[model samples]
Target: MSTFGDLFRVHTYGESHCKSVGCIIDGCPPGLKLTEEDIQVQLSRRRPGQSDLTTARSEFDTVHLQSGTEHNVTLGTPIGLLVHNKDQRPHDYAETDLYPRPSHADYTYLAKYGIKASSGGGRASARETIGRVAAGAIAEKYLKEAAGVEIVAFVASVGKVELPFAQGEDEVLGKEFVELLRTTTREQVDKELTRCPHRETSDKIADAIRSAKSREDSLGGTIICVIRNCPLGLGEPAFDKLEAVLAHAMLSIPSTKAFEIGSGFRGTQFLGSQHNDPFVDGVDARTGQKRLRTSTNWSGGSQGGISNGEDVYFRVGFKPPATISQQQNTAKYDGSTGVLETKGRHDPCVLPRAIPIVETMAALVIMDMFLKQNARSSAASLLEPVDHLPPSMILPGKNKVVETQLVEDKVVQE
Candidate 1:
């Protein structure tokens, strides 16, 4: 579905070089503070031309809040957000119309629709993500104001140049790592071109990108995102686990090839004894109720598809941009093999541009689950005590986590 989320739905529309790209947000609460300015912060980060590491094309990407809010407040209507495409060079991609770019959506999109946008991979372009970033900015604002949740993403790897979170010979996630997660922000991440907080490693990643650019090629990397203050029991378990939805959202990004949620692949190496998130008794500040706490986060803040009140962290692997200037042998529509050289403004590495997209997609999934869980608890409360339920949904503008301390509370009270 072009739409994401059951309760907090966002239906994105338009294409890469279309006159405009936008989305319709359905089901946001009434009276929430929202404005075009709120959405622009993320669009700016996602926009190209911020530096030489990304594509050379630059557009103002100014957003027009068409409908859904008045006087800077949401009326609980379908929010309409739009961004005009001002600098589109369709001729640059005319070659793609005849011969599909290797490892790109050009072939598949044509196969599925019998026709495709002759320019820019159409919806497949990273430009299509403009609508997503816009919608996600609103989702993020709602999340922060409602639940005190903060999400941050940074470059974890650039073509095998890894950082601390992806370090080798490690204790996995230790006390020091958790401490670092608390203070990480978009600003700190932006301090470096690679968006990696580590100066030395970021330089290496930048160098790799420059080398690829020099070769008329591209490189791939991974991004690590962390969610702080996630409410307990926010996921719809079994089929729609929190991790599953998150993976779904992240993989939707262009060039995203792999996804890993806490503990990740390395956890496979650990014995059951080493991998478990052992719990302890702790009190909830809001409700004054005793709750369960985990000493470690090998579980990645989730169990059985439900959030367990730990920081939710994950990694996303992105492949290099498929459209490159180098010559390649590929078949045309009739299966005749021929050499092709692609054109257009392309990034040597997509990881830097992908950082904000990862953050936004994560927020979209989190906000979706947050609303879904709230609806469930609110419904179940008609016959049961909500105090022992997972957690109440944070009302819009509340800015405080609802009094929710469950699991242990259910055991003790029962």
Candidate 2:
């Protein structure tokens, strides 16, 4: 389903090579400050053709807000935003309409619908994600204001070249590591072929892509995302857990192959004693308040499908992009096996463009949860309190009075 969320809903539409792509946000609270500029900031980050390592198609990716706001604040009405497609070369894929691009959804789409968009991947195109990113920008703003939450993601690995982990621990990488990565120049990496920041490693990766391209093949890599300062009690239980929601959102991206959180599959190697998060009460070094904490975070800030108030972090793996410029074995429309060489403007690696998409998806998931929790809490507070005096002051439901009293007390305490 295109629509997602229980309290804050978002529906994305449009396809690659279409006139435009956009989203409609149905449940954003009124009075939140938002505008086309806020959405454009993120859209530019995900736009293709920004650098040498990404695709060659260039798009201005400017956002146009259609409705649901007055002046600059949301009006508690459905918000609509659109980004027009400025550059499209549909003719590139006209010849290959009957030949599905290897590793893409082309075959599956044809198998299901019997007809597919001849240009680009159509609805399956990464272009459709523009709407998601636009809607996510607003979601991120609300989440930050409501919960003080922040999320950051980057290219953790490209091919075999992975970021160096400090002290070989699974804890969150600090600012020093971020600075180290930030200092590495794109020119230095792009100077070689592999897009690796390291000169030596990049050369190797570049050669591989060149060779793969010649052979009609592609490559894929992993991205690491870190979420910080997320409030406790954001996620739900069971099927709607934070991790599950994040995974579902992430896997929806094109070419995603795997998902991992916290220590992820690697934690399985450790015994329960080693993998357990130990709870402890300690004074906060930053806030000076006594707080409950865990010495280690193997659960990735979630336990029992709920947020544990720690950093919510995860990794997603993407396969090599389809549409390699080389000859490949495939079936023809007549049902006979044949060879074909695909031609189109494609990226050697989707990592650079994908980084923003990962962050955008995370923002959407977290923002939706934030809105749901806030709405439930607000609704619960509006209910009238009940009092009884016969023998004992008993409400119809257990803890009903206590819950009402707690809400009242909290207001007074605030």
lDDT of each: 0.83, 0.73
Candidate 1 Cα deviation (angstroms), residue 364:
1.1
Candidate 2 overall lDDT versus native: 0.73
User: Taking the tens digit of each residue's C-alpha lDDT, what string does model 1 give over 363-408?
Assistant: 9999888877666554444453333333345422222344233322
- Candidate 1 stretches with Cα past 4 Å from truth are 165-170, 173-179, 283-290, 384-414
State, as a TM-score between 0 and 1, how close model 2 is to the true structure: 0.84
Task: For candidate 1, give the lDDT of residue 347.
Answer: 84
RMSD in order of candidates: 5.0, 5.7
Lowest-scoring 10 consecutive residues by lDDT in candidate 2?
A: 404-413
Best candidate, lDDT-wise? 1
The true-versus-predicted C-alpha distance at residue 318 of model 1, in Å, is 0.3
**lDDT value, residue 36 of candidate 2:** 85
